[model samples]
Target: MSGKPGPSAAAVLPELPVTFRPVRTRVVLLTVGAGLLVVLTVVALMMPSGGAQPWGPGDRATMIITGLLIFALLAVLSRPKVVADDDGITVVNLVASRRLEWAEVVKVNLRTGDPWVYLDLTDGTSLAAMGIQPGGGRDQAVRAARQLRALAEARGTGQPGTR
Candidate 1:
């Protein structure tokens, strides 16, 4: 045998660094939604007459709570995302987040008129990956779906203990 051995699979194949996020169109919604919230809050608070008057000792606390809740909700909805590496992917939706191994995903499906990409898992469950929504534009969504499929085909097949 030659002194040099054949390259191993890992050495021959480089990992794909993949990330998916809401399209730029989301910026518009985020800007408008957040701006509207801030404006309404200010208006309502200032309408108290002669100036912005403290409603009461509890006013500051109330405002803080309200603001935080609204901000958190908006942030979550407008920031759904997915990140995938060689091992697996992490999906972040509006109210939940999940980590999944490649072998867990059975298929990637994005049908016509569908709002977002959905991953059909081997465990008979499905996950909506809203980060690549059709609202972002057909072309963008298609491209993202293709990339995700390629990643899945490359690293998300059956494996020991994962099948």
Candidate 2:
């Protein structure tokens, strides 16, 4: 091994137990979902009953259900997040969550125009870290990627410079 010392963890790594998420995306999605639900419910309740097949209880219920479904979809869109601690990292995406030990991560990447950060695993597969997505805030995503990269380099079992 080279005699040169690597950067200290305190100097490059972020505080442990930190969480990252797409703030702007989450806010916008939740806000829009709530507004849409309210508007749909209001329209269903206030619709004039004039036609032969006038709006009935079933129709109103259907409208409400539609609104609920839309809101649920938006909730899913806002669910991506990553939690990192001394032991490992937990990544929660739209439909799944996975935990990885520091030694299992080889590199952290966030290329320009990419949707989110990616973790290169020791197993040869890459995992998308939707929590640090550029679509929500580019600068924030970059900072998060760098912090995660630093953590991986500091603690990963893989050889350094792989990032």
**Cα-based TM-score, every candidate:** 0.71, 0.88
lDDT of 2 by residue, 1-163 (tens): 1122245322367788989999989999999999999999999998767686688888888998999999999999999999989998999999999999999998777777778988889999999999998887787887787777777777778555564
* lDDT against true structure, model 1: 0.69
CA RMSD, predictions in order: 9.3, 4.2
**Pairs in clash, predicted candidate 2:** none
Q: Write the per-residue lDDT of candidate 1 for residues 55-154, one digit (tens) a residue.
A: 6535645665676677666676787887888779888887888999998876666778888888878888889988888787887776676667656656
Off by over 4 Å in 1: 1-15, 48-68, 158-163
Clashes of 2: 0
> Which of the numbered candidates is closest to the native, going by highest TM-score?
2
* lDDT, residue 116, model 2: 91
> What does the lDDT read for residue 159 in candidate 2?
55
